[model samples]
Target: MEDKIMPTVEELKALAIEEIDKRKEEIIGHAKHILNNPEVGFTEFKTSKYVSEIFSKLGIEHDANLALTGLKGNIDCGGGEGPNVSVIGELDSLRIFEHPIHDLTTGAAHACGHHCQIGSMIGSIIGLIVPEVKNNLSGSIIPIAVPAEEFIDVEQRMLLREEGKIEFMGGKQEFIKLGVFDDVDMAMMCHTSATNTTFGVGGTSNAHIVKYVEFTGQAAHAGGSPHMGINALNAAMIALTGINANRETFLDTDTVRVHGILTRGGQAVSSIPSQVTLEWRVRSGSNEAVVANSKKVDRCFQAGAMAVGAKVSVTNIPGYMPRLDNPQLQELFLQNAGHLTTKDDIDIIDNSHNGGGSTDMGDLSQIMPTLHPYVGGGDGVGHSETYLIHDYEKAVIQPAKAMACVVIDLLSNNAAKAKEIKEKHNYNMTASQYLNFQRSVAEVIEYAPEG
Candidate 1:
């Protein structure tokens, strides 16, 4: 009997891309379906069920209800044992009430194009699981659909934390705490962008800390007795003013961002506000700057309470770390993307370029090699009503092809490239250290006016 000649790397890539193209309509339909039916963060029961059904149809074995509404599917290649590679898709939407496609009842909108992420994730799986492709590749492919990447609905998340349903707000953070990523060696995901370029590789995101604040005061009829009651709204306004005032002190390099939403001001306009609540965020280019600026903002909150002679409570929740994109993984993604589009059409961002945004993918990057590249097909501002995906092919199908090809390259030769990247990569923190650091960051500080 003659020994069979194994397929070349280029041949494997071609096979994967061909499979993705064959199912292009099905893949794009999934994205549109998700966009029409959006869910927010941990409350993504519908979206979770939808993705689970799709995984079931594909005959992928998976665990559901992870981190409240996450799904992890496992696909073992016929080639052999090797490093596990994760393809992640976020399964949450922003609460953009005015969005054209927003859910009327829930106000959830896929303004960030996370729906595309899910579609592309499924597309990549579809391509890789082809009999011819999987038979030649080593290692495993782990497809994940995670919830709560937006970090919104903080009050509800805090309640979840209190009930022990979750220890962290972000899905990836909760997954880390639950040891869901223990077996995974490396990961990659694509985000939808509205940039002029077709694809972008290499860029950093800010580290951040989430803040939940409350001020308590005495309530009285505003028109009847204005002097008899303390105003919590006034206290909140003062705190916001203080935050803005301190902005000048922040260095440009630190990229400090302090922003928040006043969730509750007063129940009725005729009465003084006895309670005021705010959901705030502090973001910076580095963890150190995030910590330093968080403290500064906390002091501003305390000052507000001091000025109003009211009591204040501030809860500091661990937020996402700055992104650290793996250079080798990025190069692989870029090469594959160039094949799908002209090389000049792709943007190569500097490693130090911080986008002033935050993502839980950053948390994952701290422990292992990760890629968070961007693909274009959307228009208007992200996380807003105007943001919408115009070309499903660019947003979903092309990314799927690129990611699938990258995985083929990594796992084709007994996962030679995957092993090489893993061995040379330096982790910023071990999983345990990361958990400890996040736990330490969780604390509640209460202050009452000194008598």
Candidate 2:
């Protein structure tokens, strides 16, 4: 009788690559479908459902929840292993993009290419489970569909938080509450961006940024009783000016940004507008600095509120998670990218110095060995109506393939690689530490708004 010998790692790797290549069209199609039906943030109903169908067809076990819109599957690369790795996909599409099919209801387009973000991750999962690849499995790869990376619509998110629907603002942050990463050793995510580089390696100094500041005072008749009512709108105006007053104090190294506008200054020209709302954002180069700067800005609001004797309540809507990454996983991505693209074409950015942008994945990075890399789609412009890719297939497909390769190589490969990544990152952050930090920032934070 012929022996049923297990497949070797080399054979499995080859098969995984082959499967990814062969199913390239299907994967891209899935991505484009998501692109065509762009959903914004947590409102990814169709996008999530469609991805769920795909997962169901694959016969993969999944968990659907209020937080995670798409599917999450567990693949035992190890018959029984050392560490489990998770490969995640962002399901919610950016609301703005340079597309013709615009949603009038939501006014959302897939501006940030999240449709493709989750799509590539999902496709890679399918490729990872090809018969040959599955046969050669050695570790675990958890495929997940995560929600609300964009963190837009602060008022709605605030409502969600208040209703106990979600404790944290970002999707990944909420997932962390459920101990999603308890068993996962490492994590990987790819961002579709505008740039032609080997590996877009940079971590965002993500901030626990604030969104809304409201000041309440008694409203008086416009022409009748201006002196009797405290002007809440005026307080917001003064707060705006106060922040701007200290703008010169902003250090060049810190990407300190403060911008705001008074939503409700007053009803009439003659009367005092008591209720005022200021929507603003403050950010810096890294997570810590952002929090520090926020406190300063929050104090400005407090001072202004006190100046007008208006009751003040500043609520921070859960904003994006700043990029906190594992350099180990990033190095692995860089190495695999070198193989995918020519060396001259790849530039491994030194983001150790950059912590300016914000992303929901930053929350995940704080958990496990996570790496979020950008891919060049066009010029430096993103989230703009004019933003576009020169070649949909070349720009997106190649990076999609690279992301898949990274997940497969690192997660489904030998136990040593995953172990090395997990140990190097030392994702020892406690749940309480993360939650404490979350509340600590938005409540007590003071700062100027970003322009």
Model number with the top lDDT: 1
Q: Whole-model lDDT for model 2 versus the true structure?
A: 0.69
Residue-level lDDT of model 2, residues 1-451, one tens digit each, is: 9998767655665566677778778877888888777777667889888888888887877777647364567777644565776777888756553455457677677777776667678666776788667645567778888888776666677788778777766778777776766677777777777766635775555555866887877787766777788788877777777888878887878777776555566666766777677677887766666766776777778878778777677776545545667777777677777767788777666765664667767777666667888776654367777655555554456666666666656645466677777667666456667766776665533333233
For residues 262-337, write the lDDT of model 1, one tens digit per residue: 9999989999999999999999999889988999999999889889888899999999999999999999999899
Q: Rate the local accuracy (lDDT) of all candidates.
A: 0.94, 0.69
Whole-model lDDT for model 1 versus the true structure?
0.94
The TM-score obtained by model 1 is 0.99
Clashing pairs in 1: none
Output the lDDT of residue 108, model 1. Answer: 97
Tell me the lDDT of model 2 at 383.
71
Best by TM-score: 1
Window of ten residues with lowest summed lDDT in model 1: 442-451
